[model samples]
Target: MADNQYITIMLQSLHKKEKVLNSIIQINKRQKEELENPSLDPDDFDKTVEEKSELIEQLELLDNGFEKLYEKVREELQTNKELYKDEILQMQGSIRALAEKSMEIQAQEARNKQLMEQKFASVKKQVREIRSSQKVVNQYYKNMMKKGYVEPHFLDNKK
Candidate 1:
């Protein structure tokens, strides 16, 4: 195939990859919302994660294909500097967009990670409180068992 043809294919691959990245970014935003909500739905968050994984798989496939095509056209494009300038520029633009999306996703993921850690900490505190309460109850029962004297609520009728 011609170098231009290969370049066109690469461009298409880049577009597909960009779309996948956009989907992932949206998923990250949704994940952030889930983390921020006081009452998070585990099932919904799980579904979003699973969906993002599938999109990532698609992105990987596109990357592989783009790399293969780029290798095929590398020599020609390098040697013929001005021959395929337009397509090369388009590909560069697509790459720039992809980079921006990637950065955005990274920032979103960082926020989400922090939120998740906070949620975990809150749950850990609750568990500790419950355990402490249980221990106090157990101690009270132990103390009660050692006392055999029954305290009379009403005074004895010795009057």
Candidate 2:
């Protein structure tokens, strides 16, 4: 599936782990509290024993439940590992595709750049030729004026 979906699933797994941890913590706390506040009424010793026995049975049940949860968590983690392997393979494929596309783009850009440089060089050569021709034309005009073949005009008629 998509990467975001995978992440969402992992987050849910982590939430489950958190809940299990909290339950375990709370159970341990209750057990500790009971141990510390044992019933002390001598006349109610039998009732207290019975109560303690029931508590012990409950604790055993809790322990069994925790064991089952632990096994389930382990199985889930293994499944996650397998799922992640597939995800990593998919990601690698995506990375490779992107890399290939990038390389193709870079090659196209390089070719375009080379073509531009060639065009620029051709234009520059044409400009240089034009400037050289202009210089030669200016020299020819100067020679004609010196030989009295042409006249120069002045723009002094502003009135």
Candidate 3:
């Protein structure tokens, strides 16, 4: 392939990678919003999680494809040093932008992960508190029974 053709292919791959990264970032933002909702439906959350997983898979595929294209571009440039310098420079700029976008997505994902961990911890604490309270209630009932107090049963009068 000609030098120009190699540059074009690299540029296209970079653009596709950027688009996928941007999409994944947007999905992360949406998931964060849903996480913040106290009444978020479980089904909706599941769907969002599934969509995010699919987007991540797509991003991985795009990254692999971009890497292959980048290697080809590098090989072409090294062999044909007489190619258009301006086009090669432009391709470099695009590659840099793609790298920046990927970093942004990664940062967003890290934040989301931290937020999820905090939420999980909070729930675990709540569960522990509930169990402790139940234990205290059970102990109280046992104490009453030791004092010869009989268990009381209540009948609902409402028909």
Pick the lDDT winner.
1
Give residue 14's error in model 2 in angstroms.
Answer: 26
Off by over 4 Å in 2: 1-81, 147-159
Better of 2 and 3 by lDDT: 3
lDDT of 2 at 1: 40
TM-score of each prediction? 0.83, 0.40, 0.73
Question: What are the candidates' C-alpha RMSDs?
Answer: 7.0, 34.0, 9.6
Residue-wise C-alpha lDDT for candidate 1, range 94-134, written one tens digit per residue: 99999999999899889999999999898799999999999
User: How well is each residue in 1-159 modelled by candidate 3, as lDDT tens digits?
Assistant: 564676677678777777877887888899888777766677987898899898779878867876776676777678766665776777779778878887888898898888778767877898999999999998899787786466699999999
Q: What is the C-alpha lDDT of each candidate?
A: 0.88, 0.52, 0.79
| Candidate 3 accuracy as TM-score | 0.73
TM-score of 2: 0.40
* Model 3 poorest 10 in a row by lDDT: 1-10
Highest-scoring model, TM-score:
1
Candidate 1 Cα errors over 4 Å, as ranges? 143-159
Q: Would you give me the overall lDDT of model 2?
A: 0.52
